[model samples]
Target: MKNFVFSEAVVMAGLRWTIVLIFMLFGLAKFAEYEAAGVAKIAAHYPLFAWMYPLWGESGASNVIGTIELLTGAMIAVGAFSARASFVGGLMGIFTFCVTLSFALGAPAFWEAGYGAPFLGSTGQFLVKDAVLLAACFAIMVDGLRRHTAP
Candidate 1:
């Protein structure tokens, strides 16, 4: 029984850290524009976002996305308000997933041209990673709520 409890605790801790690391790396990459050129190269291939580049410009979009990433990462890392952070993160993940899905589905012509094929790869990666992160956030929220209300 004791060993089982310890194992569960360890798993929980690992899950928490995994979520934190995901957010941290995501924020850092965005902030540094670590692969901005590559991302822009992919985006350029997409017809949907062709207008976005002209509207916001790559630098502006990067800055905005970076800010959101940093804030979300910090909120999760602090963990002081775990429930709130988890809720926010989960919602953000859902929103991101939806947006990426839309781009993936709506830009077939771009893909057919071969210019946007790389974006499909990147979007697939984002969907997988975000889905896992969303699950983690939901678990954290449920666990935190249960603990708070436990008799």
Candidate 2:
């Protein structure tokens, strides 16, 4: 039982690192003009996020998001050793995915109508992956909480 539990921990660590690398790479990409422009188009459609355009413009909003991703990734990486840090990182991940997933609703032609209502188009395919990422974040949150509370 103990060995099995330990194995699970090892697997979760690998998952954590995967999410961290994702954050790092995507965070870095946010700094580019093309990436910034793309995100701006999406954010412009999101009512909750649309206000950012007026306040910060495209580049500024993207930079802010990139900074959040970088910070969240750093925290999760440090979480390899610290349960509390992982908890915080998990929270950040939850928030990050929540926003991105919302993008799917308003994204033009997100559904591949040729197949059916449930079938997804190219943009939907990309956005749907966040559901898995969101689940992983939840697992990280639970694992971190468990580790922090354990004697």
Candidate 3:
């Protein structure tokens, strides 16, 4: 009806699709050697994923991360039809960001001066952007829950 012409649902749908597009494209890009190597530089610093460096190198580690990204994107895209998919998508979004966010702990370059200032260096600036995406994912998850539980 007229009420549906301009609505929150439409906005939520747009946000959902945006996440899908970004995640999928980045996932696909990880397959490239250059891109993977770039990630490897960072993953190398990360304790949990750094093992990828020894076990499979940048390419191998990237492939693993890429696969997960692709799956999360697909699930978010499919949130239009299934609440369960949205829930999974949201959880994945949170998981991915949490790991990336953790980089703030070990990566000194992210901190300005000696880790006391609010301002960040280039790497910190880069990683900080994920906080926004993490929030977006949380929003999507909540939206999905609202729709699913609505009477």
Candidate 4:
């Protein structure tokens, strides 16, 4: 059990699939009207994403994001066999998570009412988990680079 848990190959595969499934699932969700509207509300609060609403409106913006997520997931899935593919996938994943984490710019308001930090409201909980995913992206990037450059 310990060996399985600690094995580089096993751990790498686990990390790879974890990211793949998350992106895939969330990407698919974006196409739903409820999900798209919810995402729009959150994106509206972030300056960087504000332009998307004007340019694409709600569903269009959501579809754009969903496409990117699906593509990134596909790249990561292909990463299982190709270091270069994995490297690109990791880069995309890093960017994706960074953008999501940027939502933290508005995080204080996301805390449960009458409470503060350490107590998270719904949005706060959703955004904070990206930190772990961001770390995983870094790991994937580093390993991909190492493998790609190995002689």
Q: Evaluated with TM-score, which candidate comes out highest?
A: 4
What local distance difference test score does each model get? 0.58, 0.87, 0.85, 0.88
The 10 consecutive residues of candidate 4 with the worst lDDT sum are 1-10
Candidate 2 regions exceeding 4 Å error are: 1-6
Evaluate model 2: give its lDDT.
0.87
Model 3, position 65, has a per-residue lDDT of 90
Candidate 4 per-residue lDDT, tens place, 40-137, comes to 88885578777898888999889888999999999999988999999999999999999998887765566888897778888888888999999998
> Which candidate number would show the highest lDDT if scored against the true structure?
4
What is the alpha-carbon lDDT of model 4 when measured against the actual structure? 0.88
Descending-TM-score candidate ranking: 4, 2, 3, 1
Residue 109 lDDT in candidate 3: 74
Off by over 4 Å in 1: 1-9, 41-52, 107-126, 147-151
RMSD (Cα, Å) for all candidates, in order, is 5.1, 2.6, 2.9, 1.8
Better of 1 and 4 by lDDT: 4
How big is the positional error of residue 131 in model 3, measured in Å on the Cα after superposition? 0.8
> Mind giving the per-residue lDDT tens digits that candidate 3 earns over 1-151?
7665758888888889988888999899989998898788788777788887788877899999999999999989888788878877988888888898988887867767766568798779989989988988888888778778888
Q: What is the lDDT of residue 110 in candidate 3?
A: 79
Q: Answer with 1 or 4, whichever has the higher TM-score.
A: 4
> What is the per-residue lDDT of model 2 for residues 1-151, given as tens digits with 9 covering 90 to 100?
5665558878998999999999999999889999999888777668877888889989888888899999989988888899998899988998899988988876976898678568998778888999999988888887889899999
